[model samples]
Target chain A: MIKGSLTLDPKIIRQDFPIFQQAVAKPLVYLDSAATSQRPSKVIDAEMEYYQKYNSNVHRGVYRISVEATEAYERAREKVARFINARSPKEIIFVRSTTEAINLISQTWGRTNIQTGDNVLLTEMEHHSNIVPWMMLCKEKGASLRYLEVDDDGFLSLDQLDSSLDNRSKLLAFTHASNVLGTINPAKEMIRRAHDKGALVVLDSAQTTPHMTTDVRDLDCDFMAFSGHKMLGPTGIGILYAREEILDRMEPFLYGGDMIKEVHKDSARWNDLPWKFEAGTPNIAGAIGLGAAIDYINGLGIDQIRAHERAITSRALDMVQSIPGITVYGPKDPDKRAGLISFNIKGVHAHDTASILDTHNVCIRAGHHCAQPLMEKLGVPATTRASFYVYNNNEDIDMLIHGIEAVKGVFKL
Target chain B: MSEDLYKEIILDYYKNPRNYGTLENPDMKAMDTNPLCGDELEMQIKLGESDKIADIRFNGKGCAISMASASILTEMVQGKKIEDARQFNKEELLGAMGTPNLGPVRIKCALLPLKVLKLAIYSHLGKVLEGDDRNL
Candidate 1:
């Protein structure tokens, strides 16, 4: 037996999430955290407290509640900055989702910097959010988009990266951890290489920041985008962290409202670092909820969470590989991968497998997983993805294995 | 037993699909893809005399529901007239699947072949009305 490294007691952790208390078709084996994590009561209570106590807009209102609301919102920003280890809170710009964060970068930074014949390097394992924005930006700017190929084992080829990172490459946009494959790319080393090649790196940490400890300063990435919902927080809130200099240089993405210093009839000067990017009213409650989520994760300790997930993932991978005709994707070493596994049983469709698992109260994400390009590259239509989190334990993996066996039984394989 | 969405018939159709290939010099051919799942179906119908579907075939890749539905669709519309084939609705397709209570996502997979068939018929009608005989 592999030595267990889980420090957090999942039984106790599940108590913090009240969703388990409610009735369902069967016992919920939530293995879909990579899609969206279930929110804990702390995060839910934080948002509820915001609405119950001070539910006013931020920045403009000088009333007492407004001031308190603004303070809470900015405090959330500070919490996020500290969570990601950014130099200052001004580097953290709140957006709707990871998709919006990437879009903001593409529109502001990409529009300004990318030129005709410039290349934006993306990896094959990227979610549609990371790939689509760059594709649109490159098309609009007449710049070319290149991909860093993923090998058969679901790891990106460094040789392909080296060859692709020519002087014409302006930005290296890649996922820190793949949502489907669970392969954690070496962001620090890749960032260093891209910086040497005179290219800015945009780290799509939507799948990474929630699971592992992330330090933007240490990674030295020019920009990083991640969603709140994927990290046990509410949806409609995401963070985009850019260096101060880069934020100062790029134009504002959305126009109008609080993003401006003064709105003249003709042209107007923009607001300071973060506010200029955050136009209109933001997801106030979502941000505050994310702050509570950060605290929850911090209290549990991200290192311990990573270890716990690694243990679950390692066990799942081992047991899954033992099954006949099962093909598991991503790195074999548990340390190299995030807390998830993507696999397929031979002669069984991923949807069928997922349906059967769902009947067994095991929730695994199936379909192309918004990474059609990667699916095509993998030579499969789709694969079933089961992602783990702090609340998931060895029992969940055992349930999933049993669910897979049930699927085989149902299919008469 | 309660969760038998993958019935033996569905699996049989998926494993041994009927009329599962391309057609040469077809009268109508159209394709539609489920962008969410990357499921695609390309349908071809060779119209015989009196606008009857003399031969119908489908070629694509998708989940069991989609592929089986496509296979079943080819068998359903093979001898039907163009007008009758075009009139085939989602309920009839779902009925053929033997599972009317498909979940939201699977519904899309089950109806993809019907959508493609309707589009093929529409294209054929459009071409005939436009006085264009060349294959589309």
Candidate 2:
């Protein structure tokens, strides 16, 4: 069933990415999209066009080129808002990356709302970016930090959440998808539960926003953050989506030009919602490139992309599990996963597995995946991970399985 | 995949590993892991007079390249000076391996034992070996 959705002629998708054209020592079977996606021609061209034709500082200048740049930058924000079904461009604020976006929210909203003796709820699956900032805020505010435990398979246990939620829970920040485990959490339900407990929910959509359709309204999350680089756009730009009411409550994270309206020697009045959060000259080129990424994604359709990834993941899971010595991590059901899988083979360290795969010209991620807590929970120091994207196909999965088998054969395991 | 990448000599060492366990009377010890891939190594060295490596042993978990590399590394450095062993760089090691295409990951596996060796040797002898070029 998934095969039909993710099914495409690999030759066509291959055309869009120039890197695939290179005749490397081995086949470049890229399976690390969970880290950052490979860019298509459209995104590359969009950035090039901006630099070549309309290179100028935006928002401040009244000149034609600057006007064009400013318009392009704002238009990209509109595209981002639309991509996630956000209500308005005002809801979208660009930061350097998802880490920066999360930091902005935690420092601003967290400092203002969370009081001493209050609690901030997080999950064990959160990346350092999502977990550490909250930890910093909680430490400063004398607020306690609580955790929602994950199951043996690495899924967050709602039962743990049920027991943990309380009056003191002011903020519930968790990931929409586990970066290490690739487990897709039910954000809408999680949001509802948090709201019932009178706690605002923040979704770390860094992993999910790239692979699936993220309807912020449907999820009812107070804030959502994702990076542009992870979605085939350029690096150094990210998006933070907050509900208008929530945006009104937060303080500005950074204070500088463009974020302030009226400045006095002693006091300064901040600008409107989004601009207040985005201080200094923003990533205009990155924003335009992100817009092109949005267009590329839209052209393919996110649902279609999700379906394609599911297909690749299903095949990958089946193949990896079928191998006698392999120990698959995360949920067994492919439907519960997003676009990636993690596993280990008995007697094979993940790094070694990756090295053997590299000899085959297959690129995979091997490590804690920046989720040390999750790695501990999974009872492994590290695992080999193969994450997928829209351009990935069953052949890639086949290549991965073959690579693993070759590694096994080489080891005579 | 070329059979030369995982030569029989390397595989033989991995399967029938020498110095596979930690030293009983270790004069120096170090344990380190490649954070990127979770490959770990615990190396123990017994130093003779002049801080020569009287014997070396290792015990840990990793892939074929790492295990084989550890197996090869112990054999190469067991009777050498701690300082001389520290000077063994990637090129020298790769030259010893007879090829440079152990792949980066495997090379790291091969180097884990060496890194631990260097750290322990530096602390024990108060001398740094400058030959392990990490840039490769």
Can you tell me which runs of candidate 1 are displaced by over 4 Å? A1-5, B127-136
For residues A221-330, could you state the per-residue lDDT of candidate 1 as single tens digits? 99999999999999999999999999998999999898999987898999998999988998999999999999999999999999889888988999999999899988
Reference-based lDDT, each prediction: 0.89, 0.84
- Tell me the docking grade of candidate 2: acceptable
Winning candidate number (lDDT): 1
Model 2 chain B poorest 10 in a row by lDDT: B127-136
TM-score of candidate 1 on Cα atoms, chains taken together: 0.96
Interface RMSD of each: 2.6, 3.1
Separate DockQ for every predicted complex? 0.49, 0.45
- Residue-wise lDDT of candidate 1 within B11-98, one digit each (tens)? 8998899999988999899998887667888998898888889998999888888999999888888889888887777787789889
Q: What is the C-alpha RMSD of each candidate to the true structure, in Å?
A: 3.2, 3.0
Please give, as one word, the docking class of candidate 1.
acceptable
TM-score of 2: 0.90
